[model samples]
Target: MVISSQKENDVLIKPDKVIKYKNSNIILNISNLSIGYDKKVIAENISFNLKKGELVAIVGVNGIGKSTLLRTIGGFQTKISGSIQIEGKELTTIDTLDLATKVSVVLTEPIASKNMSVKELLALGRQPYTNWLGKLSDEDIAFITKSVSLLELTPFLDKKCYELSDGQLQRVMIARALVQDTSIILLDEPTTHLDLYHKVQILKLLKSIAHKTEKTILFTSHEIELAIQLCDKMLILDGRTNPFEEPCKLIEHKNFETLFPADMISFDANSGSFKIKK
Candidate 1:
């Protein structure tokens, strides 16, 4: 991956802060990228490179553009400027059909219908590779079966999506992404609305999937403490230099200390968690 050190007046370039990695497995590379609506920039100067088998989290306070950054990277929304390259190809140049095989996205929005069986919902992940008639090949079925087993969804395969609880449905959604078999999986708030135990369970599952399957998994999350424990790397969208590095390095640099109001909560680097001030 190329790391540009050139400085621009309008850009918040941090060549010194950015970590450099020499690996052929790098699939997703974002350099000085900006994301937002027309004429309104939500975040800028974002730079990071993700390699296969890495589970990364994008965390920040609410409205810090974590979700927007995920959408922009997944190609659901437009980027204002800079680069988003998948395997050396620009994101904008790739067409929808071809892009589907490279990146899979899971958003926080509700499904169109929960009446579909869990197995049926997972079958949709292979739609990109299916023929015009939308028939699943043996390979596709095998992929679905493998993902089901990995996510522990076998017991719920015949059950309707509506019958599953929040945690189960979330696992199903992640399983669907795994079934897609894309090189990169982008999830927006994958652990939202879950209790602490379930939240940890889901994050641990994601970390396992990424490592065992060699898929690059990136998710936006509010569970900063859990993310620090489970993620291999993290990108804090502070809207400035947007520091991206390993979890230990981020904590060593005290990035989480300034994430919120100092009067309310403070980061305890010793324990790698945020504690409310008394």
Candidate 2:
């Protein structure tokens, strides 16, 4: 597959160079992936390579296994078949401790400690590197500080999680993942329960983080239009053919048109957004 950048002027004219560069930069590789419970597959034959510094989105209609795919990649659920690789190493070979250092996940699950301060919650991300007594090293402290600053959480550091708004808490959770210092970050519905402005704000922050830190940020989103505008690449999981490509290429190939039923909605390739059918 040809890897296209978001820039309209930049084009990959040489296939060989694109392949070589993609191979060297890939952070996560999924091949022939089938995800489900008890051998009942929800989706199958999924294949994609996520490169470093790319912000990708997994989008599909509800109940189409978007969360199932993310869960499988995060190693929280068992894959029915196929392989997942992180930085060229098979995911199965990586131990839990090692995996923590490679990938950080932010799920939609509610935090148990509503009274925990933002700083305390973010510091928990360093558990993989902490001593048996759960003490942070100087480096760990620095990481936490950097994460707090990166997400601009200094003002909320002392605030309890329960007191923060949904958007604020989501940023705190993302900061926690960032403090984990992983190369790949997986988030499930990061924009859930937020207003339109906050949703855009969060996605823009993620896009900036991916580009600035050279990290692969993959999240599942119901905000398809916003994702198409912000993400560098997109993975469409429509149950028939899962296609992972640059947003423009996916549109060019007419992949988005098959995403939903035609009776109510239709994809507009020119606008790169879905529209209500008249």
Candidate 3:
């Protein structure tokens, strides 16, 4: 795959602190991406490149197509028209299983399994690498063990999935994705239906994972302030307009507050922070 990277030796460029990649870093490139359902266009002309280990937060009002964007990125939507590439390779050109091995996803909806345990749910992530019958190898077990522990789920390993709280369940889902061992992780409204505290906890957890594990994580969130505080970058959509960026340098260009909140509030450009734009 042909991933692009900014020259680290360039004194003018700030260092990218996203996750570390093996051999060399490959930035994921999404170009002219358009997505839709059977009868309607959800979004179009979307383009961006993500550096390895970067954490991106997407924000848009309800029905603004944020989740649709993540679905397109994860290959879950079939009605997309555009190109997605990782490390210089076109995403559509790769095999589905190969794609699975390269990307993992978590959705906001709770996973339902009347008979599964937390351990089993996490183990399912290794299916892409396992035998046809989904048999676990020693390597799979090792990944599962590490993932659960990272989520602090060791005490609940054998506990039934249905018995866990919403917070615990979210962690289990994340652990499942981690065990999949993919370079890109997509989460669709991960904070949905969460209490305020759990919402903060989950976003914080994602930020920590991006820093410690060096994983490329992109998730949709409605918690605007929280997302801005913890995410390395932000992708924002306003109605039928294009997606604009909130990078470290170009944040003001987005005109963030007025995009969603319809008020004449003001934001300070000096601090590189935001408030309601007046």
Please report, in order, the local distance difference test score of every candidate based on alpha carbons: 0.90, 0.88, 0.76
Clashes of each: 0, 0, 15
For each candidate in turn, the TM-score is 0.92, 0.91, 0.83
Model 2 Cα RMSD, 1 decimal: 6.0
Stretches of candidate 3 off by over 4 Å are 1-24, 239-251, 264-278
lDDT of 1 by residue, 149-252 (tens): 99989999999999999999999999999989999999999998899999999999999999999999999999999999999999999978899999999999
Candidate 2 similarity to native, TM-score: 0.91
RMSD per model, one decimal: 5.4, 6.0, 6.6
Tens digit per residue, CA lDDT, model 3, 1-278: 44446443221111342333342464577766777797688877777778778889888678878888888778777636666766656676678999989899998665766469987888889989999999999999999988877789998888998788878888889989999999889998888878989999888888888888889999988776677778888877765545546554335564564564546544455654456553
Best by TM-score: 1
Ranking by TM-score: 1, 2, 3
Instruction: Kindly report which residue stretches of model 1 are placed more than 4 angstroms away from their true locations once superposed.
Output: 1-22
> What local lDDT score does residue 20 receive in model 2, on the 0 to 100 scale?
30
State the TM-score for model 1.
0.92
